[model samples]
Every structure is written in C-alpha cells, then in structure tokens.
Target: MKVVSCLHAAVMVSDLDRSIEFYTGTLGLAQVDRDLNYPGAWYQIGDFQIHLIENANYQASDGIDLTVSTRNPHIALGIQDLEQAQQRLLAANCVVKMSNSGRAALFTQDPDGNAIELTLVDPERESTKKFDII
Candidate 1:
C-alpha cells in the first residue's frame, strides 16, 4: 500500500487548553468540531488534522530517556491499505503498535527512532482540492 497523504501529527502536552489556545490563537489554526471522547483537541490545518493530546502521564518537556525513540512525538500518514502496510512493516521486521482506539493505525519507528504512524484514509473525508502552502 502507498501513503496517500499526511493525516495528522500528534503532540503530547501537559495542558490541553493552553496548547489549544496557542495553536488556535497564536498560530491561527481553525478549531474544528470534534467529539470530546478523549483528552485531546483537533485543529484543521488545511486538509490535515493536528491532534493535541493531553497526557498527564507524560510531559512534553520531560528529558527522561525513553527505550523506544518513537514513543516521543509522531506524524501520522494516510495510507491506501492498513493491512497491507502492516504486513509490509512486519515483513521488514519493523516493530508495529496497534492503536487502542480500534482505528486502522500502525505505529512504528524509523532507524533514527523517529516515530511514524500509518493510518487508513477515510474516503468520505478525502479532499479533492490541493492545499496551497504559503
């Protein structure tokens, strides 16, 4: 399967409201309507989503070294097929973590320990127009 586009990038934060204000007020990202099913907020970045998750267990500025480098911040990419991507990653001996949200997602790491998330694209949400980067 091929990566269709970048879906979202998740960043952990201590305060969700503060981060939301910074992203929306400071950065001028439009806040989209989302279900508060979890401790996070979704912002519209052109056609992509920026997910700000409030993780009380972990702080973004924490200097503690982690075993898995990919456990830090990560970027999620949209893919054509989730199962095919999982199989490809497994075949390459890449460590893949399944999403607990039951969404079609696979989290893995690069050689440098950078986290990467592969997610299945929802056809209904796909945009046809190209995003103009300023």
Candidate 2:
C-alpha cells in the first residue's frame, strides 16, 4: 500500500503566540482554525494543516528540549525551489542549519526549535509548488 496524503502537521510549541506569528504571519500560512481562548492553533500550509499546540509543561530527561531529538525528526516540506525557500527563511529570521550535498535540501527551525526541512525536486522527475494558502 502507498500513503495517500498528509492530513496534518503537529509541533509542540513553547510559546504559542510566537509560533503562530511565525507560521501565520511570517511563513504566510493562513489560519484555518484556532482555539485562541484555548492553547492551540491550526494553520493551512498548502493542502495540509499545521497544528501548533502549547506544550511547555513537558520536561524531558535532558531538561533541554532545544537539541534533544537530533536525528532529523522533522517534516520534510517540498518547495518549488531550494534557493527561494532559503531566501524566505532568511528573511523571516529562521535559524538555518544544514543543506544536502546536492544543494537541493535545507533545514530550518520554528520558534520552538521544531525542525522544518525544505527540499527541491527536479521538475522532470516530480515537482510540487509551495501553495499559497487561501
């Protein structure tokens, strides 16, 4: 069997407001739904929805959530071009970390340090656009 599509993306945010700002304001993801009175918000990232949930109460053994999971536990987002995504991330002040050997992949982080990767696929092979959320 093959995976059909991505339903949603979830990120544990330390500060929900800041995370919302980065996702909605900076990243241009629209607010599909949000429980502002509560502790969560949902954003429309292309066809998939990104869920930002407040999780400051969580405390791991390391006591530092910033660099705990470093085995590339992140969502690999596809972009029209790697260079474009890099420029956008740089403009938004997202902390860029690494890039693939082929120069077609790059990594960045959210306000809560959740890794978000951008990959560029050759159009001849298979391509997709970074949709504009409506």
Candidate 3:
C-alpha cells in the first residue's frame, strides 16, 4: 500500500457559520456542496480540499500561536502573489505575520485559530523541487 497524495485536511471548529464565513469570506474560498450528515464545510483549491468540521466543544492545540512561526504545524498553501494575499488578509482584519527567513511567505489564522501559511509559488521552480525556508 502507498499514500500517493493528501486527500484533504479536516480541522475542528466551534461555530459552523463563523468558520464558513472565515474560510469563504476571508480566504476567498468557495464553499462546495457537501452531503455529509454532520455540520461541516468543504472547500476545494485545485486538487486539494479543506474540510472544516463543526465541534461545539472544540479545543485548540498549543501550536495555535496565530503568529508568524514556521516551527509550528500549519496548513501551507502556495499562491501566485504573496503581497496581494497579505493585503487581502489585512483588509479582512486578520492578523498576518511575514516570514522572517527572507522568503515571500506570510502566516495568518482562521476564526477558530487554525494557522494558515501563504507562500509564493513559482511554477518553474516548484517542478525543480525547490524548497522554502520553512
């Protein structure tokens, strides 16, 4: 057996509506139709998907620093423009921290304290297996 690729990431949240707003409104992700029986939301980005599960008693881990710290575990997404993304996040009243490792990357969090990282992705360099400072 082999795990070829990641299917999706499921993060627990407290409020479904608030999380949906954060994921959709703030992150600019479109909510896809879901058939699950539970309270949750699914967002598709290219081939990857983010699953948000609503848990009223949700508890965050210690890594929920909500700051610019690549040392913590967070969802990292490759985007075309880092500066633009940062501006959008700031406009949405989200706390953003730029990567201090000389890389075009930034960090932010969702309404539920889910850490998210946005990094500039070069299509040509990505195929060459180039890595970021993280």
Clash totals in order:
0, 0, 0
lDDT of 1 at 120: 76
RMSD of 2: 5.5
Q: List the residue pairs that clash in candidate 3.
A: none
Instruction: Give residue 33's lDDT in candidate 3 (0 to 100).
Output: 95
Candidate 3 lDDT by residue in tens digits, 1-134? 98877779998899999988888987889788999899999999766799999999997776666444687778988887787899899998998988767788888888877888888887666654553433
Best candidate (score: lDDT)? 3
Residue 69 in model 1: lDDT:
35
Q: State which candidate, 2 or 3, has the greater lDDT.
A: 3
TM-score per prediction, in order, is 0.46, 0.69, 0.86
**lDDT of candidate 2 over 1-134, digit per residue (tens):** 99979889777887878888888776667787565675888877557787888887733233323233235667766566666767888898877754645446777777766677666654553335433311
C-alpha lDDT of candidate 2 relative to the true structure: 0.67
Quality of model 1 by C-alpha lDDT? 0.63
| lDDT over C-alpha atoms for residue 127 of model 1 | 76
Writing each residue's lDDT as its tens digit, candidate 1 over 7-79 gives 7777776677766665565334688888878888888756788877777665434432234433557665666
